[model samples]
Target: MRFVQVAQHADDLKRAAAFYAALFDVEPAALFDPPGLLFFDVGGVRLLLEKGAPSSLLYFEVADLHGTVAALRSRGVKIVQDPQLIYTHDDNTLGPSNSEEWMAFIEDSESNTVGLVSHTLAAGD
Candidate 1:
């Protein structure tokens, strides 16, 4: 099955929209003014933000680790964890191998945990 959309509750739609726009470096494709629902295109995935209960965590895979982190920081988004390297071992040889993946967590005004991830593994790796 293919993934379609993920939704997060926002306390303030405008503020949350701005936060996400800055974090992802793209504006929302649509916004429902009366209902306070905003939609953003994240690569091939769709993210929907509306006024409701806050979410615990939402993970997003991004292309540019440094640029995404910088944008989030500039917008005053709280960083729960900074980007760091993680080591993985080869399954067959048990040899040490390194992969560059970065993770960061942030809470919106409504206390939704937004996680940013950058996976460095190749298609077949």
Candidate 2:
């Protein structure tokens, strides 16, 4: 099976939508005012933000790691960690068999954790 959508809890939908739109450079596909829910399009993925708790953790993969991080920072997004390289192995491969990628995390106004990831495979494997 494939992953379809992820729903995140937000204290305020409008604030959350504006924060995400500024960070991702895309407007929400739709917003339900009474329910306070916002839907965002991330390629084929759909992110649903609904009013609930104050904090949550969400992850999104992007192509431009540095640019995205910078843009998010410029928009007043709180940076939890600067972009850094991380390596992992699919299996317990021996010597120099690990793959690497870049990733970063940020906190929304409500202190929710949002991760930005850039994979090596999509950059041409």
The worst-scoring run of ten residues by lDDT in candidate 2 lies at 89-98
Candidate 1 local lDDT, 21-86, one digit each (tens): 876778898998887778999877788888764574787777776677787778777767777654
Best candidate, TM-score: 2
Error of 2 at 38 (Å): 1.2
- Model 1 clash pairs are none
The reply for model 2, stretches above 4 Å from the true place, is 53-55, 88-99, 120-125
Residues 54-111, model 2: lDDT tens digits = 3457777788888888987887778899998776545436212344567899997556
For residue 14, what is the lDDT in candidate 1?
Answer: 82
Worst 10-residue lDDT window for candidate 1 reads 87-96
Candidate RMSDs in Å, in order, are 4.8, 4.4
